[model samples]
Target chain A: MPRDEFERLDSTWASVTPPAARRMLIAAAAAFSARGYHGTTTRDIAAEAGMSPAAVYIHYRSKEELLFQISRIGHATSLSLLTAVTGDDPVARLASAVRVFASWHAEYRTTARVVQYELSALTPEHLAEVAELRRGIEGAVREMVEAGVAAGAFDVPDVRGATLAVLSLCIDVARWFQPDRGRTPAEIGDLYADLVLRMVGAKAP
Target chain B: MPRDEFERLDSTWASVTPPAARRMLIAAAAAFSARGYHGTTTRDIAAEAGMSPAAVYIHYRSKEELLFQISRIGHATSLSLLTAVTGDDPVARLASAVRVFASWHAEYRTTARVVQYELSALTPEHLAEVAELRRGIEGAVREMVEAGVAAGAFDVPDVRGATLAVLSLCIDVARWFQPDRGRTPAEIGDLYADLVLRMVGAKAP
Candidate 1:
């Protein structure tokens, strides 16, 4: 966890908090994450939120719309988390990015799971939009890796491959991580951040 | 891939290739993979197989049984692939294992997808069985990492974390890979093999 990267994430957090919308987004994210989009109805979301199903329609036009909203928020939050942690030094930036990523996945496991797993169920239009959001996140990581390579802080033949490796390490956390699985999320996050930094040939801190 | 892993996979292939059962399993795997287990009806699998709905019941006792069968085959195939690729040299063994894994996920994307995405829909007994099978595969990888460390071929403080990083890279291929995505399966396999090898701090060939 580099100090600079932590500041980047904190700044993103500052721009995105409206109490009511945040609560609705959290409920919607949980439902969408627990069940696949097609498998979850608006009623399920409303029930999770302790509101009537009709109340959901007031905020979102349709099921697809709700999914879109969730996807957008989830993607933005992840990007912001990454953006917040990026530092001037590529090695510190990479390690901090991995730390933020692993922690975010653990904290928002359900939302992350739904966004990753349920992409196929989105309408073509919505799917493209989600894909774009994903690419934005990937692109930012790629830029960091390229910068690292330029500064000789990393040694990799392919920046794209390194980006995928880093992202995969974080995304797969949701698959096996259990709250009672003998390791705290922060511990796992720190270990993974170190592993990823080394994977990219970053000097040991 | 190691010759032993290849032999094991060949053996499993031989045992599971009775035409009727193979066809049924393939059909069920595709349906389960696409629509998920609970979301997919027995009639859907029957229709996909071009058999009467009753035909499915004749072969398998219940939908749950069908899923269990698919899970068994999928896990067995993955384990066999790993066993086939392991070598005496820890670095070569790790690279070969990951190459086989990535290639298998590409070739059997549907089966891989079903085995991964539909786990939550399985009965408790079935889930435990699948979990055991997964543990066996993870154990094999962990042993390889331990061997690598013992041989001074790799540098990692945590064997379990290193193993997870390697597995995560391969497992995620099923999600974002497409034949039309500009890289052939072999290319993707090779690229990922290199990444995993480096992640463990193995020397390049």
Candidate 2:
């Protein structure tokens, strides 16, 4: 919190932040989302990013690492959204959290698609990190569900199954949702939130 | 039914069913399912079939055609399962159909995974065919839900949204399901069927 310590922290962050590497990561995420990880090569990502294949190596050690970076960001964003939606009323909090999660997924579908479909390509260690992040997100939702049950605001029999079902509903949207689809993202998000509320046996507020 | 016509039909079918081609189709399905469509090549499929790549060409015109065949088979199998579960009671029939669907998806996760995930890789023409087949499956479920609604056996507010939510839950099991995850396919199928039934406000029979 001291001025000199804060300046040192900022300098250290700036030193590691490579703009070219960030562009390559974006390109890799897009390619990996369209084609599975096994289907893409470093050259393909490099071409998309307008960089030499060797330049990609300079930024990341391997294609898997690039994917891990994308997954890590997506998982962290989702966890942060969940953390930000806390409230005294668990039902209202859960509905808001579900809406935020669904909207984020629909808006950033490419990242979500890559994270969901290409997870098997990660090394065991990277996979564990991603899985742990996922568990943290699930835990947030589970806590809200448990709180609702304890407060008599929800009547779900199995909190874990309910959480999985709600999350599944949101995550699978990336597969079927198209921008030209009849429903807007917000419309879909609202509909899913209603469905999730019903599934959790939450009374309309 | 005449002998001459029967011979004509048999010869027509034989001309379409070369042994090398049959092997190629099977191998292509497995390859597409395992490595994904874009990740797989004709050579990989040919090697799996123990035939030369030229041999695969002799049977199918291109890899796209091979994918079309696999998608057709998967769609037909899924539709047949739904149709086979018809019953007098709409609720029972709905639950049974969902169980069959979830079980088939779990058992044949690989083929279902490929068909669902790699659908975008299909040629526009082939995609239309698959889409029609998918609509047929959705239509059957929609009709069942409508019947249940008419009979007052279900209390869902939005039939189309409910149908989509139900299908999404079942289709997405292939994404996260692992045999080592403590939940068997059958158990997951049962749990999903129960959850779907509850969501629709169906009374357990």
Candidate 3:
């Protein structure tokens, strides 16, 4: 089930953020992801968390801050999950990265939906920070593409475009995934890993 | 720069839709794309369209109607554009379709963004209509992929997954396209066509 991913995400979040604050952020993520940032109110978020509206400010300075935290945590987790796929070969690295990235997007789709879609609502300062983390994720993918091309492990015509497409395909999972629908997260990850390998023109291990 | 695409979309919209109603839809599409559907107010749309608040109601019954219209038009255009690319050969058809679809997404990004990203704001009845339209686009891609594989022109192992990725990559252009960014819509179209051609393991003709 999704319990493993949720627990993993929850513990990872708790490592850097307080539990009460994380609860508020979780509520904010769901509301923001579903109703959108502008549609969601602090009162709605507090109500979702089963707390009085006044209690929100004790944990988050504003509704935007709640969104900012969700975006931040989501980006950090995405970047870390992507960059963690390390190995001696770029082919394996790329496939592993795509698998993990795709899995996380599907598993944590609620948080990812807000993170990926609600960037415009973030304060400029916060948006910039999130963008940097996004760049980190992009950079990790670009590195794998370059490594594969340099080693002659893959035959990509346009490295930058392929890198963008790879990230694009993975991030879109958050947009379209429904847990009960067609494929499981693992199935999607496995499918995408193969498709990505083909994308890079990887011959074989 | 993007004027050609804007004019083209405008003319296409005018062909079937009334000019005044189209104007409101254009405004709502921009607002919904920029600020999100829920984030954008009917007042904001009316003001942006240079009409009084009540003028908006004269054209469209409600803000949701405005969104439904835009989504409907966008889906129609997307389906037409994708299916319009036809040839005896699957490779050529697929490349042409991706090129046109990607170009439109980049060129008419605001409309495409609202069409692609703002569907959740659409009421269920409207969303089902749009989803059928979306399925048309998917069916077009799937046919091309299946034809390519059947003809032995492409080497995709998983037809459904590859179809999903091709559409995923093209649709994502709406999410990330910036007119002032590095690549033009035409350029992106050409780049994606080549990449997608490569993606299907098509042997160079």
Candidate 4:
């Protein structure tokens, strides 16, 4: 994508959260992704967000809360995308799902690097919430697989295992996808959509 | 596996590194997996290995070396297993590759978790070395994929992308596999083997 298009794509969370909170979350994701949550102090987050160190507490009660917010929002966005996918053709739904899912991880690599890899940083309560959201995302994929199997459009031995593999393949894109390296988000999405269709034993289109 | 068998399996690394150095590596993997590379101190690793804090530097010069060691060995181990997989049939090769790959991630979850996730902490020089090792592992998978495609055993549009997805699915097993929660390592290996076969459009066995 073009530079402007990339920035526009990145500003997606801006409309969802308040300006200050979003800045904090963005700053937190950068820091956490670079050095990890435990190594990143609230002061560092405040500095990155261009606020006084004490300003962090006014927004998030603790550093973990900042992580929790980032994790929740990222997972919620993914879950919403997965669950909102519609239509009777399971193959199409799975393709669309993998496309956006792969694209999001590539586009928001920074946000996703923390969200997917830094789950250990969250407290128990927050981790449970994030895992539940993850389960929802997995459930959506499972639904698509089951539907496809029922329709004889796809053949999968283990729906749950295949669902996990599908998500895992997409999520790891965040870990390895660099802006300058390899394929664009759209390219990866298209590739993964095809690969996943094959994974489900869909007849060649 | 039985407890003794688990102990024996965990000893896969012991023969390569001396007992004390292996202890430090084991301790470091646990700490890095739990708290991440930045959050984990040499003191924590030493303590985990039941050594005085100063004793850590005797085996490993710095915490980063400990991480590098674990990552290098883990990658090497994975690469060895992947490249050593032999068979005339590419489909069988892919299935065997996924089986052991997924099983290693699940059985050696703690070690695999640190090796795969704590890589960001490596210095540029060390990272390049580790990346080279990783490319070897990826190359092995890609080779099997290419062979499958050549023999008309698999129909994959993007062989490179499909190769990545297969390994990504297996590697993430380290991140999420819980020993107490569900399937054993062999079961997951068998399941992933089947899923990967479907992914490559291999003829059903």
Candidate 5:
């Protein structure tokens, strides 16, 4: 990881007010990523943060609540990143979207793992909340594909299927990314962006 | 799911000796998939199998062992499917490989879930054992990609990266597949086959 990327990952929780709450969220994400959500207890989160177990309750009512916060923030951040992408054309826009979205998963592997894998551990109501955000994420990708197709810049037989494949390819990055091995996140982003353009039948940019 | 597909999923454990042990493995897969390895207990597995808690021990030493068995078997089964694909051309072979491998995740969603997600819970020795099968799976895909490039049937800039994307796209089907919604497993297979060929720069079949 580059120094800037490392610093950016460390500052993921900077927006969370009151350092104590942010600390708990970071601890919970680490625990959940290292062990499955079910395997981590509130005490474990507290211990990881060097705070008393009761201090954890002060910021979050329960472990699941902490998970929900981590998940919501992570999803929102990724969605913003996707929607915020700027490019000169549909092809460039979609490629840029894939580049940033795919790399985010690699750079923020810990939060990405917890966000992607631990959804089933959330309460039904909380899951519903996160699912709405997920819909936004999916919609963002779909729209980019659709725009490229509509602009006659890309050829896609089944837009939904193509969109699914693109998102699936990117989302699985969190599961397998290794910091010490293989390509850097930016390199992955570049590779994926090129491959995704192929899938969508976008002309070479 | 079709009746034949349902039966095929049920027969997944048919090769495991002794109907009693097969039943226990099936039970463990269901439990581990539903509640995750950490949230599930030996008692839960036994209850799901309709046997005493002690009966579980008779079949498998521990819950982690049961997970190991499911992971090992599932990985082996998918690996065989990938390597068994036969076609007159590299394009056809790669398409067949992706089709079956991706659909297997959907058709056998329960086992696939446990197989892909619960590996972390396996003991290190068991995990290493399964990782060998995983390597075989990766090698199978890489070889098919290499064959395509060698035959001038596909244009791939990065063989290793393309191979990773191909396998990643297929393996992730397990995480999002829903039996009651959207496309059938076979339909997904067809869609993915087309998209993957597009990915490798294979001409339309």
Candidate 6:
């Protein structure tokens, strides 16, 4: 079953010690979500966080660093959520992964938007760091799909393509998810879990 | 079978009149694709098109207007391509639609990137115009899904959810497509057609 509540904005950043730095990161995320990375400046983030622009520089080297922090943390959180699924059955495990993955995008869309869409804005070094986390995320999904195929619980002709489709479907929730419109994050997770199972030719669970 | 070559970049914008205006739009699309809308400036578009900043205003009112033209044309062209698919069989028609839609995102990824990701930057008036076309795109896919369900060709437990998933999967092709890596757009179309058929629970075509 899906969760009944949305995640608090600061919940994702709780691990970042120093309340001031966390506030700056949250402010940067909201600004980036509303405005593209290029459209946002350190002053905008600092202002949003109720700090001086110099204060932002003290916490992060540049706006890109702030973005990198958000992307790295967001990707790590989703990856951990996905790999933490507990189940021996491939079908059930894959379904649970999709449920949490899809819901995470919706639950933390503000951060997800910056994480998923702001890749090009990151410096090569920052992007390379985030890409590692992304690969882990991709590998986690691919392994589950492979497990299902190996166990004869699913029939997939192209495992890689199927994996791409599943990840693409879930990541896009950040682009179009509206809190007031359509299904809740959990409902979307449930719906996507079913569709993904069908995509892999898994029987209804 | 998939096509041997990708669609020309200007092919989608061929209908735009006055060669100069079309050149500016193409330049804007490339700039937007690489640097993003917020990062691009009129000087960059003019420089890319080998024209002066004033020449841009002659063709466009502002940078946002250039973005609007690219977005509006891109959305309309995809909508037309989707709605133009032939065949009376729901299974075949839906497959064909997914094939063309998915490949279009890849073949014309420059424009597709601006169309799919740069939507938040469109002016309210321009967004309203594009939203109409988006609704058409969404409705076209939903109708195809509904047709398959009605003909007993598909076993979709949730028509709306299924439609959203199929469109989401195809639309996301623009976000991750690379010319040098992975399958060609046409191959992706073919694979996606098969996967989408599975998604709707239709027997293989």
Give the whole-model CA lDDT for all candidates, comma-separated. 0.75, 0.79, 0.83, 0.83, 0.86, 0.86
For candidate 3, write residues B78-160 as lDDT tens digits.
99988778899888889999999888888787777777777877889999999999889889899999999999999988888
Q: Give model 6's DockQ, 2 decimals.
A: 0.65
Q: Give the TM-score comparing model 6 with the true structure, all chains together.
A: 0.94
- The sequence of per-residue lDDT tens digits that candidate 5 reaches over residues B141-177 is 9999989999999999999999999988988988888
DockQ for each model: 0.46, 0.45, 0.63, 0.65, 0.68, 0.65
TM-score of chain A of 1: 0.84
TM-score between predicted and true chain B, model 2: 0.87
- Estimated TM-score per prediction? 0.88, 0.88, 0.94, 0.92, 0.94, 0.94
**For model 4, how does the per-residue alpha-carbon lDDT over B86-125 read when each residue is reduced to its tens digit?**
9999988899999999998888877776787677789999
**Per-residue CA lDDT of candidate 2, range B1-205, in tens?**
1233224323322433676676676677678766778889999999988999888888789998988887887788788888888778989888888888886676666667778888989999999999999998998888888888898888888898788878888888877777677777787777777778777877555
Which of the two candidates, 1 or 6, achieves a greater TM-score against the reference? 6
TM-scores computed on chain B for all candidates? 0.89, 0.87, 0.93, 0.93, 0.94, 0.94
Clashes of 5: 0
- Write down the TM-score of model 6's second chain: 0.94
Clashes of 4: 0
- Per residue, candidate 3 scores C-alpha lDDT tens digits across A45-145 of 89887889999999788998888888888889888888778987988889999999988888888778778777888899999999999889889999999
lDDT of predicted model 2: 0.79
> In candidate 1, which residue ranges exceed 4 Å CA deviation?
A1-28, B1-18
Clashing pairs in 3: none
- iRMSD, all candidates: 1.8, 1.5, 1.4, 1.3, 1.2, 1.3
Error of 2 at A32 (Å): 1.4
Candidate 2 wrong stretches, greater than 4 Å: A1-16, B1-23, B203-205
Q: Tell me the tens digit of each residue's lDDT in model 6 across A121-177.
A: 889998899899999999999999999999999999999999999999999988788
